[model samples]
Target chain A: MLYELWILAISSLVAATCGIVGTFLVLRRIAMVADAISHTVLLGIVGAFLVSQTLEGPLMLIGAAVVGLATTYFIQVLDNAGVPADAAIGVVFTSLFSVGVILVSLYARDVHLDVDHVLMGDISFAPFHTIEWNGIPMGPQAFWVILAVFIIDLALILLLYKEFKITSFDPALAAALGIPVTLIHYLLMTMVSITAVASFDAVGAILVVALLIVPPATAYLLTEKLSRMIIVSALTGVAAAVTGYYTAKYFNVSIAGCIASAAGALFLIAFLFSPSQGILLRGRQRKKAAAPASS
Target chain B: MQEWLQFLSSPNLQWVMAGAALLGLASGVVGSFVLLRKESLVGDAMAHAALPGICLGFLVFGRETLALMGGAALTGLLAVYAIRAVHSQSKIKQDAAIGIVLSVFFGFGIVLLTMITNGSYSQSSGIDEFIFGQAASLVGADVQILIASALVLLILSFLFFKELKLLIFDPLFAGGIGLPIRFLNALLSSMVVLVVITGIQTVGVILMAALLITPAVTARYWTDRLGVMAVLSGLIGGLSGAVGALLSSTISGLPTGPVIVVTATAFFLISFLFAPQRGILFRMMETRKNTQFVLNNFLLDTMYEKLEKRYAAGQYSALFSRRELEEQTRLPRNGLEKTIQALQKQGLLTQTDGKYVLTGTGLAYAYDSSLLRRIQDIHLTHEAELGSWKEASANGDLRKPRDYLMNERIHSLLTAEQKLPVSLAIKQSSIEYADQA
Candidate 1:
């Protein structure tokens, strides 16, 4: 039960961190780029391993930042060279990810990295890897790492709320107003990279994508204001984390995968039933709008 | 190389390579349309979405390949619909919709996969094979399916080539021309789904998109014509498949899907850097030559203008020293030096006692350059009247301004606007008088 609580805490922190950062990505309409970053950060982990022989240091975050930025850089290169946006994203991420996969198979054989763990992470073991200071046991290492990430993300988002809001809504206006649109974009990307890597040990790379995109997307359907949306997105992520934990426990399935599925389920509910933007309500409004004309 | 050739000669190896090649060919052909339609990542979303369906099929029907493929197709099509629904039904954009559907469905699929792994199903072990594909496990029946799918894809693409071409390039025109745009779009999406279903066995879901995008994009660098691009894309995809299959088979412990993706990306990188006309290397060289040409023209124009000013001021000794030329052109010293050396090598500049003057041929060339500049000035000043010329100039053939001046309509328009240069105006009247005689 204690382990289950630890897993739930870690997963919620992971989801909340992803939720806050992913809000910016969805607003900028670069959710696919986030997906690409999620995939290619595997290469970062492998690279960090190759460099430092471990995946448990600040080197992992640094590697993820470098590779995540490189993924966007390569995509920009292809875009400037006349490749369409989707094809540029598809090609860059896949190629880099394939290289990562090949490297893992070749050099990281002694390590405990496998494709399965990379796809669907094992959060149940989060309790076992506890952090120690002065012979006293702290919480799980993943919990602390993700908590630090969550705090940093929330603080940054709070500090730069106006900058993020202005840049995301109208980049041209932001540039005209001297808001440093490109810098804000890269800053957001860095935060996303850090959050993704921090959540990776608990939720895996792919489910991190789910937690990143699905919660913000669900919140997007619920609210129109950026501040409310961030709050709603984080809340939705926490909700999914809690519910998904129990669901996974009952079914004896992957906790991270179940959390992602739970996030998706929440999105479906919000999509079909949100007061301002639900599909059923919109369809009814459309019918009412058409009735007078038909009559 | 000898060992590779011997390995290729083995019958089993040949069969697997052929199967992979066919899969690659089909994906490449269909992927061309998908890439041109800007739906390259839809194949990726469909591939991920097919996982749960495959698991559901295995749960229900045990291990029939046809049933599994059917299940994959159903969910794949469902994912497309879901993406469309999310995009159109709300304020969420297409990219977010695709990401949401892709990751969520894959997450759900992982849940099912974990269930099957932990379940008491006897044949659950092989189900994981669909995740990271094992090309070595492919048998003759799978190869036969690949062959048939490849044939069907080729034949349909051939039949629909004209409509697909029109649809991708100009959907509005195609719709105005009464083509069934919706049906054609559905046909293309269905073709993508078919490719994903057939390909998941060889390349898996995660990297399946690379097979669809890399070859198509690589082929795009080498061709502008759609028909040629599609054919080239198919051939490149086939080659990547055959090569990747061979390498993975020979390489012990290497996964086939990533190996195949690496092979396709290798082709993409090669094409990106070195293909002619559109390749990065060729573009860099072309840009360099253009810079040189622009510098050359600027130097000649500046020299001609300065010499004209001196002649007008009645200074016959109008030769320019290198320092004066550099100060006048305002170009950087090294570029100025290079341009001067090139002009001298071309015999367009003659040096006398550390001073430079244009040769007779160089004088004529400079005169034409000035005349072209005058015409451009007139065009810009009288842009409203010269709107048609804007389109013509956009073709970038301004090497001979005299040809445009000779056009009676342009000449009369320029004269009416009083925008013609004095020299060209007199020359035009003389030519008109000569034609009258």
Candidate 2:
């Protein structure tokens, strides 16, 4: 029961962190870059492991962040050179990921890291990797790490709320007003990288992308206001984490996988039933509008 | 040498090589259309979404390749449908929709994979090979299936080539022509799914997209025609596949999928840097040449304008110093010197001591160019009734405008309307204005 609580806390924190940063990504229409980053960060993890001979410190986060930014940079370069955006993203991420896989197969074969672990991270083991604070168990290390990330992200968003909002809504206006659009973009990308790194330990790499994209996308259908959207996105992510945990327990399957699946389910529900943007609701409204027009 | 010989003769390795090459060829042809339609990542999502279908196929039918591929095709098409539904039905964009479908379906597949792994299924051991793709595990039956699928895909693509091209390039027009746009779209989507199904066992889900994307993209750097691009992409993909298979076999612990991706990326880098027209290096050279050409033209125009007054004064051999030309044009000193040297080399200008003058050929060239410039000015100033000036301006050579809008008739029309001032008078006034400034 205690371990389950820790798992819940860790995974929920992971989802919430991902949702907060992912809202910006989805809004910016760069959600696939989130997918690219999640995959290439495996290379970062492997590279960091080789250098530090460990995977437990800030180095891993830094490595993932560096590679995440590099992924964006490469994609931008290709985009500037007239490569289609999808092809640019597809080629860059897949090539980088292949390199990462090759590196893992070659050098880090004996280590705890492997491609499968990177893909489907074992979140059930999160509770066992606890941290010690002055001879006291301070819960799972992943929980603290995710909490710190969540707090830092929230604070950053709070501080730069106006800048982020302007950039997201109207970048040209933001640039006209002398806001550093590129700086904000990379800053958000860095935040996403950190959040992805933090979440991947709990939900694995690919599912971290699900957490990043699905909840925010679902919330986008529900609300028009940015603040409400963020709150709703985080709540949706948390709800998925809880329900996904219980569902995984019921089915005796992978928890991270179930969490992502649950997030998808929530998105489907909002897609069909949201008051403002749901397909069914909009269809009914359109029909009523058309009825008056016919009279 | 010994290992190479053995690898070539080995039947199993030959099957693996053939399988990978066919997979690459089929995907390359199909992927060209996908890339052109801007649905590259949609292919990626479908590839990832195939996992759960493979798992379900395993659970239901138990290790039958045909059943597994059938399930994969169903689910892959479903993923495409889901992406379209999400994108059209909500405010969500296509990229986000693709990301959602990709990760969620993949996540559910992982859950199923875990269930199968922990279950009492006997043959569940080899199934995980579909993740990273163990080429060594590919048997003869798999190779034959891969070959057959590749042929079917190739033939379908060929038969529907025109329809698919129209759909990709101009779908609205295709629909207007009553070409069953939606059916063609579904056909393309199914082709993508078929490619993904055949490729999943070779390249795996995670990197299967590379086989579809890289070669097509690389071929794009080399050509603009869709037919040629499709062929080139297929050839490049096939070559990369064969090379990747051979290299992976030689190197222990190297997976065939990543090796193939790396090989395709290498091809992409090569084309990116060295293709004839679109390559980065070629573009850079073209830019440099364009800059030099523009500088040369500027130098010639400046020299002719300066020497025109002296020529009008009947001192046709008159000269101006490099410093005067530099001050007049305000071009960078180094560029000015290079342009001057190039003009001299082309026999467009003559240099005596430290001064320069336009030769006879150069004077004639500059006069035509200057006349074109003045006529353009007149056309712009009198915007109405000068629509023909745009066609004249489209002429590259100053002499060619005479065939369009610069003939004596148009010149007389302009002069009668007082739009074309006396050429000598205009130059004299501009010189006077220059002196005053």
Candidate 3:
């Protein structure tokens, strides 16, 4: 039970952090870029491990952040060079991801860098890897890493709320006002990379995309204001985490997959039932408007 | 070489190779329309969305490949519809909708896959193969399925070639022309879904998108004509599949799907750099030539204008010393010498006693008031445009200039300093154009 609680805490923290960053990404219409970043960060992790010769180090996050930024830079270059947006993303991420896969298969086969684990992380065992502070147990290491990322993300978002808002809404205006829009954009991407890497060992690389995109998308469907959207997105993510924990327990399946599925299900519910944008509600509204005209 | 021939002659390897080639051809043909429609990643989303259907097929009707494909097709179509619905009904854009649907469906599929892995179903052992694919596992029966689907896709695409082209390039115009645009769009999407289904078993869910899109994009670099692009794309995709299969078979531990993706990407990289017109190398060369041509023209125009001014000042002699020409045109000596030589070679100028004289043709070219008038007209129009833009900017209307002034002639006539504003205006206008579209 204690193990289950730890897993829940870790997964919720992971989902909430992704949710907070993802609201900005979805608003900027670059959630898919976040997906690209998540995939390419795998190459960074492998490179870091190859260089540092250890899986447990801060260098992995730094390496992954650098590669993630490189992916964005390459995507922008390709976009400017006349490749279509979607195709450029597809090309860069897949190529980088394939290189990462090949590298792991060839060189890191003897280490903990298993491609399968990179694809589908083993969150169930995360509780066993406890972190210690001066020889005192501090719960699971995964939990602490995610908590630190969540706090950092929350603090940054709070500090840079107005800047993020102005830049995402109208970058030209933000630039006209000397907001350093490009720097903030890179900072957001770096935060996304850090959050993705922090949660990678718990939710896997690909599923990290799910946690990043789905909850925020769901929250967008539910609310109009950014503040409400962030709060709602975080809540949805936490809800999915808790519900998915039980779902995985009952079904004896992957906890991470279950959480992603739960987040998806919540999005569907909001898509159908949200008061302002719900499909059925809008249909009824249309009918009512037509009925008065007909009468 | 003998061993390679023997390996190629092997029956099972032959079946896998044939399946891959057919799948590649079908995907390429369909992917042309997908690319033109600017929905390249829609194929990616559909491919990922097929995962849940495969698992549902296994859970419902056991592990028959056909049944799984049928299930995949159904769910893939559903996902496409869901994307469209979300985009049309909500404030979310198409790309966001695609990302949302893709991750969600694939996530659900992962959940189901986990259930299968933990369950007691005996046939579930090979189900995970759908994720990364196991092309070497193809048998005679699977090859038949691939062939039938590929042939159907080819025939349908051929029959609807003109319609697909019209729809892809201009759906709104096609609809205005009463072309059943929605039905045509649905058909093309279904074809993409079918291609994804057939490809998943070979290239897997994630990398199937590379097979579908990379070939079409690669072929786009080789030709301007759509028909030629489609055929070349199919050929390129087929070649990549065959070569990838052969290479994977020769290698010890390489996964076939990644090998295939890498092979296709290699083709893309080569085409990107080396293809005839659209390749980077050709574009760079064209840009260099254009810049040189523009510089030469600027020098010639300046010289002509100076000559006209001298003539207006009552100088009758057509010949002028190089130093006089340089002083009048304010040109560097080396550039003036080169331009004079080039004009002389073109029979527009002649050298006499260290002086440059205009030939009859050169006189006609220099006195061509139409060219002068055109340049003046361009300058006047640009000044007018600049005035309006300044007024608009002052009025706090931040909208950029529209695309009415992107003429290459105007671009060449502008000086280096003038080109910056023109290019910036073009960029802003093009962005606005894309946004409106």
- Interface RMSD, all models, one decimal each? 0.8, 0.6, 1.2
Q: For all candidates, what are the clash counts?
A: 0, 0, 0
**Candidate 1 Cα misplacement greater than 4 A, ranges:** A287-295, B1-6, B392-399, B402-437
TM-score of each: 0.94, 0.93, 0.85
State, as a TM-score between 0 and 1, how close model 2 is to the true structure.
0.93
Chain A TM per prediction:
0.96, 0.98, 0.98
Candidate 1: the clashing residue pairs are none
TM-score of chain A of 2: 0.98
Number of the predicted model whose DockQ against the real structure is largest: 2
Off by over 4 Å in 2: B307-317, B388-390, B395-437
lDDT by residue for model 3 (A1-295), tens: 8998899889989989999999999999998898889888889999999999999868988988999999999888778767788888888887788778767877788888887687778899999999889999999988888888899999999999999999999999999999999899999999999898999889888888888888888899889899999999999999998998899899898888888889888988888888878888878888998998999
The parts of candidate 3 lying over 4 Å away from their true place are: A285-295, B176-178, B307-437
Decoy 1 TM-score against native: 0.94
Q: Tell me the whole-model lDDT of each prediction, alpha carbons only.
A: 0.87, 0.87, 0.82
Displacement of residue A253 (Cα, Å) in model 1 is 1.6
